[model samples]
Target: MADRVLVTGGTGKTGRLVADGLVWRGIDARSATRRPFSADQVRFDWADDTTHDAALDGVSSVYLVAPTDRIDHLAAMRPFLERAVARVPGRLVLLSASSLDRNGPMMGEVHGWLDAHTSRWTVLRPSWFMQNLTTQHLPSILEDGCIYSATADGRVPFIDAADIAAVAVAALCDLVPPSGDHVLTGPEAMSYDEVASAITEVIGRPVRHCRLTTRELAARYTAFGLPEDYATTLALMDETIATGAEDRTTGEVERMTGRPATTLASFLTGQRAVLGSAGF
Candidate 1:
């Protein structure tokens, strides 16, 4: 049982990066995926209690990404987390969102539990990902040349998943860098409209921002096959944004990783080919 780190969402945006980062740092990184396709990956699913033991066995630390699409997921995750606390005996870094506070909502509740339960923990509350416009909203951008959101004119310091991973890797390595939740954000905040405009400039195509009501946005998420409650919660975050709730930025990324956070324009420029394919 060396100092190995178990990444729960090994195949996800940040999880893979965290795993790779750990490996690059000469750390033994174990990736936990539901379907194991590689020697480095162990089978793990939040719904399956049977898969928890093997995935957590002999691990020094865990980078937790809560079960997707399961709103109020603390109930399902507690059994495994309680086991992790006893079995792992190392850091437990959670990937929560910037909008969620300690004991506020889904992952927030998990945050509270970890604080009350253990001393070795760090909760990362990152702002919206810059990748969302390229992934989740890409279909609309390609088909209709538009980006959709309920946060009309709301600003967000959209962060790169890579930066989040960098911070997570640092947290796992340090074990106890800080005592409370770390709210990470990009260097600047901009609106979805600005995001669309940035894409337009990058791809030389007219991309518009389509504003929807919170209800409308929730419906759209459901259309994308998300559960109703989860979709509603996500859309409500947009409503929160509209009131300027997320109109701020923090230097957690740089402070943790010793690098400047990536900007939206730089990220979109890197994705120019993907974003411009349909336009051309």
Candidate 2:
């Protein structure tokens, strides 16, 4: 029988695509969401231990997506991960961020733990997702025709979540899974200003990037109902980008998936309808 892969956060941005890609590759992909979206998706929550066994049942490989509600996410995830490593036989792939160093903070702690514990594991540390413009930041963009950020003039190789998913599929399916972390990025680095211009050109709308101080950005996130500390941490991430930490490109996407990374322009062109729509 083909390996059964458990995809945590299967309804989420990248995890959904990962599950789809695995299915397309003729792999048995089981989506593990908090609520089952389909009969195929198993209910799994990192904070809830009750859902773990059913999700892990008959599953060989696992795709790990950390819960986003808390900054100290490692604490919440530790129990489930311990169970996963103890139970699952195939490789484990973790979804982490490029800005976060291994063994540093948040998902980094998970990264460190995976390295020390799992014999077959791969950590995907991808740069900012281009989907952010279409999903996370789309609300403000549609309502105000502006992109807000603390990363002043910072350039990011904004990768498509699709590319990240492809890489994850490769890691999960490979006979010999890559053991270390992979820093995935797009073909080129682009600033928020350039991203705004691209969206404006694609949608024929007057969109602009509104640069804000870290404190202002944090306050904006807090206003949007995010916890104060989580909001502040997000703002700090942008501030880190502003310091030129994320202003580089990598070929890991092509190396792993045998295809060039998706360009921001192509992503924006494909998302033009969403960008121009009144309801996103």
lDDT of 2 by residue, 88-200 (tens): 98788999999988898999999999888877788999999998998889998999999999999999999999999999998999732468889999999989999899888
User: Model 1 over residues 83-163: C-alpha lDDT tens digits?
Assistant: 998998778999999999998899999999999999888999999998888789889999999999999989999999999
RMSD (Cα, Å) for all candidates, in order, is 1.4, 1.6
User: TM-score of every model?
Assistant: 0.97, 0.97
Candidate 2 to truth, TM: 0.97
lDDT of model number 1: 0.91
Worst 10 residues of 1 by lDDT: 172-181
lDDT (CA) per prediction: 0.91, 0.90
